[model samples]
Target: MSIMRRFSFNHATAKFWDQREAVEACARTGSGIGLWREPVQEMGLEASAKLVKDAGVQVTSLCRAGFFTDPTQAAIDDNRKAIDEAAELGAPTLVLVSGGIPEGGTIDSAREGVKEALSVLAPYAGERGVTLSIEPLHPMFASDRCVVTTINEALDLAAPFPAGQVGVVVDTYHIWWDPQVWQGIARAGREGRIASFQFADWVTPLPAGVLTGRGQLGDGCVDFKRYLAEVDATGFTGPIEVELFNDALWARPGAEVFEETRAAFARVLE
Candidate 1:
């Protein structure tokens, strides 16, 4: 497939962009979208689903569900709800950020929590036709965002489940620095576990918030073309979602953000 044909704009890239407008823009561009739960809820599940469906926009994946570091019944329940939401929206994958170390818990213990939670939810997700995609954030986020810090670790967590039930997301912003990223991608492909693939550049001197540190395509050190070739070599031809977060970008108009992001993506990959 053509690169632009596989392009997807994640709503969080322009944090405050109106959902309908974003989806419409994606439709016009023949792109896909990665949707978040809050905006979907605010837009009402039915309405949000209709908006994408009417526009003929593909819902690439749901932003998140996990945070099951403790694996409490409540956490499991909430993730189940997220899975349901993903099903309703026709999202094939539900990205999971295993929450940080819980109170009185160590990182290792938190990882155990993720394993147990997946055992419970993976089957449910499989039954509903949604893949629970484990996302290993940069180690800086290990304590509070996700205990899984490497693609290998995430793969280990997903090992027990069928590829259709659980998989890993390869988000460049998070895993680009991993020494074994290429191996992990090849392994994921061999196992059919590449549930979702996302792009975001890693600019140096991260912002104070850290979370808003993602750079626009071509603005940083990440090699987007190389990443594309790596995944393509894995025989995966899925949508490549551009998910960047910048406070300044968020502060601007959404339509402008779309144009800038579009140009930036082409510059970086084409």
Candidate 2:
């Protein structure tokens, strides 16, 4: 198969794109797609599932299902629902962005909360044949977006559970700045915890919130070839999802963005 066969387009790259059009684009290109819960729900779960299934497209992963830094019952219930949705959509992994510190809580406390929440949800996800993928966002967002800021930390949180039930996401955008990234990737591979592999270049001059500033492949400082080599050395031959959150890309037509992003992926990998 061609290397492009392993490319999966993440819907958030074009935040404003219509769900059906995204799926159709993926279908046309014979690529997989990573979906978000909100759009999936808005388009109706069963309908969304049918759309992909009929189009012969794969659901690389479900965007996210974790935010239980506080570990409340409601949070647990919601994650269970997310797992159910992943199963319905034939997504093997459900990404988890462990929420940041809650009010009156320290980062340490939030970390503990994530551990407790996973203890409750891991078994449920396992039963449904879905892997809970912990995604470590950039450290800049550690205070408000995601407390999990390193692959090692995510691996540590996942260590307590079975590799099949709990795993880590290796997104270059979030980890390229880490000095020990290569070591972390090897360790994750050794532990059999690499559930998802995503790509998003890191650009400077981050925006105010720093949420929608993800750079396109080859436009930023990320060394895609190096990342690919390291990940391949780990024996990880899974789909590589390109998940950019760029404001400029969002403003353009979805089809145009998709084609450009796809070409960029190929160029960088080449």
Clashes of each: 0, 0
What does candidate 2 score on TM?
0.98
Per-residue lDDT for 122-231 in model 2, tens only? 99999999999999988988988799999999999999999999999999999999998999999999999999999999877776646888899998899999999999
Residue pairs with backbone atoms closer than 3 Å in model 1 (clashes): none
Which candidate leads in lDDT? 2
Report RMSD (Å) for each prediction in the order shown. Answer: 0.8, 0.9
lDDT of 1 by residue, 1-270 (tens): 456888899999888999999999999989899999999999999999999999999999999788999999999999999999999999999999999999999988999999999999999999999999999899999999899998889999999999999999999999999999999999998989999999999998878878998999988899988999999999999998999888989999999998898888888887
- In model 1, which range of ten residues has the least summed lDDT? 1-10
List the candidate 2 regions with Cα displacement exceeding 4 Å: none
Backbone steric clashes in candidate 2, count: 0
lDDT of 1 at 237: 94
Q: Model 1 segments beyond 4 Å from truth?
A: none
